[model samples]
Target chain A: MSGVEFVPLSLTPLLIGVFSAVACALPGNFLLLRRQALIGDAISHVVLPGIVVAFLVTGVVTAWPTMIGAALASLVAVVMIEAVRRLGRIEPGAAMGLTFTAMFAGGVLLLEQSDTSGVHLDVEHALYGNLEALIWLDAVGWESLLDPVALAGLPDELLRIALTLVAVGVFLWVCWRPLKLSTFDEAFAQTLGMRTSWIGLALVVVAAIAAVAAFDAVGSIIVIAMFICPPAAARLMTNRLEIQITWSVVFAVLSAVLGYILAGYGPLWLGLDNAVSAAGMIATVSGLILAACALWAPCRMRSGAPAQ
Target chain B: MTVELISDQGIAPDARHPEESPLAIRGMTVSYGQKPVVFSVDMTVQEGSMTAIIGPNGAGKSTLLKAALGIVTPLAGQAKVFGKPLRSQRHRIAYVPQRASVDWDFPTRVIDVVLMGLYRELGLLRRVRKTHLDKATSCLERVGMADFADRQIGQLSGGQQQRVFLARALAQGADLYLLDEPFAGVDAATEKAIIAVLKGLRADGKTVVAVHHDLATVHEYFDRVFLINTRKVAEGSVAEAFTPDALDRAYGGRLATAQMDRAAS
Candidate 1:
C-alpha cells in the first residue's frame, strides 16, 4: 500500500480540490448576482437527507440515485421557502432561514431513523469532507497513469468533480447571454421575451446541481465558501462578465491549490507534526483573497496598482 | 371610465395593418391590491409622432406605461402595439425604463449595457458577432459616450447615465420607443440632447411615447398629449387638450397658480 511516488500521491488531493472549487465557483457567480448566496448554504444542508434516503431506498451508495435525490431536495427546499414566505407573510431572508433549519433537522432525523448498511454517508462527512483519505493507493508516477491498476486506483471523487466541472462549463456557455441579461435587468429581459421567471428557475436548478454534485467529496463548508468568495473577489477586480468569470475560476483554483498545500505542509513546517483540515483552510484563503481585493483592487482603490 | 377622442387629423388606422397604430390601449384597468391605480384607460398613439403621458404624482402616469409594456399586470383590458399583442411584437418595441430602476453600480461597462439591446436579435446560444459589436459601437457614438465605452456605468453622472440608456434604446432598433421619465433629473444640456434624439426618431418615422413631468416643455417637445388623473382626462394635440379647463379637471385646483398657465403658454 506504500510507495515513494510523492508526485501522484499529492496530485490526487490538489486535482480534486481544484475541480471541486472551480465547479462551485462557476455557478457561484450567478448566485452572487441574484443575491442567492445563502441558497447555496441551504442546498448543502438539504442534500444530506437526500443522500441518506437514496442509500436506504437502494441499499447501496452510488452517484446516480444520490444526485437525483439531492437535486430533488434542493428544488423542494426552494418551493418550501417560497411557500413559507408567501403563507407566513414574512420576508424572503426570514423564510430561507426558517426553511433550511427545519429541513436540515429533518434530514438529520431521517438519517437516524433509517437502518442503512454499506453506506458511508454521515453528518460529520457532510460537514467536513473526507479529503485526507482520498489519496491514490495504487502508488505510481505520471508514466504509470496508463497502467490499468493505477487508473483503477484513481479516486472516484476526482472523476466525479471532473464531470461536474464540465457540466458547469457547458451550461454556462450555452446560456450565457440569457443568464447575464436576466441577472442584470430582469424586467427588461422579460420585455425581450426571455421568460425571466423560468430562466430564474433554471439558474437556481443549475446552481443546485453544482452544490449537490460537490457535496459527496468536498462536504458543504468548502462548497459554500467556494460558492461565494472567489466570485465576489473577482467582482471587485473586474466589471465585464466574461472577464469576471475567468478571474473567478483563476481565483478558485488558487484557493484550492494554496489551501491544500498550506493545510498539508504548514503544520509540519512549523514542527506541529500533522496536517490541518484542507477544507477549512481553503475557505480561509478565499476570505483572505476577498479582503485583499476589497482593500487594494486598483480598479476602484486609490492607493494601489490595479490587480488586472 | 374610458375616454376616446377622434382627432380631426388622426389618420385612420390601416385595416390590414390593424396592429400598425404604434400603441393602442383599450379598457386597461390596473390596481395594486384593493386600490385602483389606472381605471379603464383607453388611448391610441399615432405613428411617426412624439406623444406625452402627463399626470400629477400618484396619478398612475408610470403605471400606464408599465401596463402597456406588460411589465405590470392589468386587472382588465389589453395593450397592443402595431395592432398586435406586446408579446408577439416585443422585438419591434424598445423600452427605456426610469434611469433609477437598475443598480448603476453593477459591474458592467457602458458598451455591454448597449450590447444588451442586441440580445433579442442574437437569441440564445449565439455569440455577439463582430457586426453586432460594430452596431453597438455606433450606437454609443451616437449618444456621444463612445469614449466612455469601457467605463463602468457607476462612473457616469446622472445626465451621462440617461444618455447611456437612450443609447441602449437606440441600439434596440425598434419601431416603437417607450421611455419613462428620461428627463426626471437631467441637466439642461442633457434635456436638449434628449429632445434632439426624440426629434431624430420622429424624423426617421419612429413612434415615441414618454411619461413626461414638466408641463412647460410639453408644448415644445410633444405633438400629442394624454392628460390623466387615475383616468384619461383628455387626449388631443397640445393646443387642444392642454386647455385650462382640462388641466383644472385633472389637477383639481392644484394648478390654480399662474405659473401653470404660463408654462403651457
Candidate 2:
C-alpha cells in the first residue's frame, strides 16, 4: 500500500477527537484545582434539559438555539447548585449530585412529553456523543479564505477547528491568573479583590460551551472524560500551574487521536462489538493514561530534577 | 497592666473608635452546628500594631479570626476593616491560615502561593504581569527565601513553610494581616524571624492579629495581648495583661497551673 492510502481514513475522527479533548481539558484543570472533578459529569448531565428544551421549543435540532439554550441551562444549573449550598449548607459534591439528578430527570420527562424521538435526540448520544458522524462531516471540505499567493480552498473542518482553537486560546490567555488564583484558594482570591463568584460562574459557562461544541463531534461522554482525565494525570506529574496546564492539553489531544485509531481497528481484531463506541473507548484510553502517569510519576520525579 | 485606653483616660476620645484600625469586631458570635464556640465579643485593633490573641486550646482563638475574616459568619456581630466592612475591604487584608490546616500535597510552588497574595491587587481577568513577579521576588527576599523562590512549598522545612506564608502576606501589601497559628510547628529560628517581620509591620503602622498559643512569648513577641476564653478576658499591654491575676481569670483554675509553670520557666 502507498503511504498516502495508509495515511489513515480515520483522520477526521482524530481531528474532532483531539479538539474535543482539548476543549474539555482547559476547564478540567480548573475543576480539579477547585476539587470539583465531578462537576464535569454533573454539568453534562444537567445540560440535558437545555438540549431537549431547545429541540422542543424550536421543533428542530439545529446548532445555534440548541447551544444557546444549553448554555443558559448550564448557568441555571450552577446557580441552583450554589443556592442549595447556601440554604442547606451542604457539601458541594452532594449539592451538585442533587441538582444534576433533578435536572436530568426533568430533561427526560420533557423529552418524553415532546415526542422528539430520533437517533439525533437519543440520551446515550447526548451523554456519550457520536464520533462517527462527526468524522464523516469533517471529511467534506468547506470554502477557504482567498489568498493572493496560492488560490486554494481550505476545508470547513479546518476553519471550524481554527476558530475553535483561537477561541479557546484567547479565553485561556485572558483568564489565566484569575482561573489559577480562584482555583488555588477561592477565599484568598476573594480577599485579593477577585470576583470569586463571577470567576466560578464563568468557568462553568466556558465548560458548558466547550462541551456543546464538542458534543456533536466527539460526543458528550468522551468530552467529559477528556475534560477530567488529562488534568488529573497532569496533577500527578508537576507542581507548577503553568506546566500542569501545558501537559494536560498535550495529554488530552494525544489521547483523543490515539483512541480514535485504536477504536477503529481494535474491535475487528479482538472480536469486540462492531459499533466500536468511539467516545467510551477514548475515555477509557484517557483513564488508562492517567493511571499509567500516576504509577510512573513518583519514579520520574525521583530520577529527574527536584520540584521547583 | 492597669488596662486603660487613651479613650478611657479621655486623652483622645476618638482613640476608642480608631478609624485607621484594620479590624473592629463588635458583638461577634459564632457557632458550629448547635453549639456556640465564640460568644459575643467586641474588639478594636489599631492600625500597624502587632496584636496577639493568646489562649489555651478550644478557646475560640482561630474561630475569632475566621469570623473576622468572613470565612465563618458571625452569628450576631459585625467585623470591619479600615472603617469598612470585611466584605468591602477584602483586598486590604491578607490572611495567613494555620500551616497545618491545608494539605501539603497540593500541587503548587512557593512562588505560586506567594503570587496568590497579589491576586486581589491584580484584580480579575488579568494575567500576572512582570511587576507582580518582581514584587513576589522582593517579598521572598524579605523572608530570606530568595534562593528558594522557585521551590515547591512541600519540599521546604517547617520553618521554610512558615517563612513562605510570611512572604505571601508581605506580597499582599495589605493594611491588615490576620494570621492563624503562625508560630505552630515552627522552630525557634523561624519564630524569631516571624516575630521580627511582625514587629516591623507594627512599626510600619499595619495591624497584625495572630492566634498565639504560647504564653511564654507573650511578653517578648507581642506589644498587646488579648486573653480570650470564649469571651474577652482582658486586652492590654503584656506587662499588665500577662499578670497572674488576669491569667487565672482567663484560664480558670486548671489552666492556672500550666500558666504558673510557663511563668516560672
* Native interface contacts kept by each candidate, as a fraction: 0.46, 0.39
Stretches of candidate 1 off by over 4 Å are A1-4, A86-89, A115-119, A300-308, B1-19, B125-130, B253-265
Q: What is the lDDT of residue B247 in candidate 1?
A: 85
Give the Cα error of residue A44 in candidate 2, in Å.
1.5
User: RMSD in Å for candidate 2, one decimal?
Assistant: 5.1
Per-model TM-score versus the true fold:
0.90, 0.83
Compared with the true structure, what per-residue lDDT tens digits does model 2 show for residues A1-308? 34233222355556777877888898888888777777777778877899888888888887777777777787888889889988999999999999989999999999888878663787887867666654332122222112322212222343454466667767888888877766656666655656777888778777777766776455668867877899988877787767888999989987887777678778877877685777888899899999999888642352122222
TM-score of chain B of 2: 0.89
Measured against the native two-chain assembly using Cα atoms, what DockQ does each of the candidate structures obtain, in the order listed?
0.41, 0.35
Top candidate, metric lDDT: 1
- Shift in Å, residue B53, candidate 2: 1.1
Candidate 2 residue lDDT tens string, B8-76: 765432266566467878888999888788899887776556788977778889999888877776788
> What is candidate 2's CA lDDT for residue A7?
24
* Candidate 1 clashing pairs, residues 3+ apart or interchain: B18-B83, B19-B82, B19-B83, B20-B82
For each candidate in turn, give its C-alpha RMSD to the true structure in angstroms: 4.7, 5.1
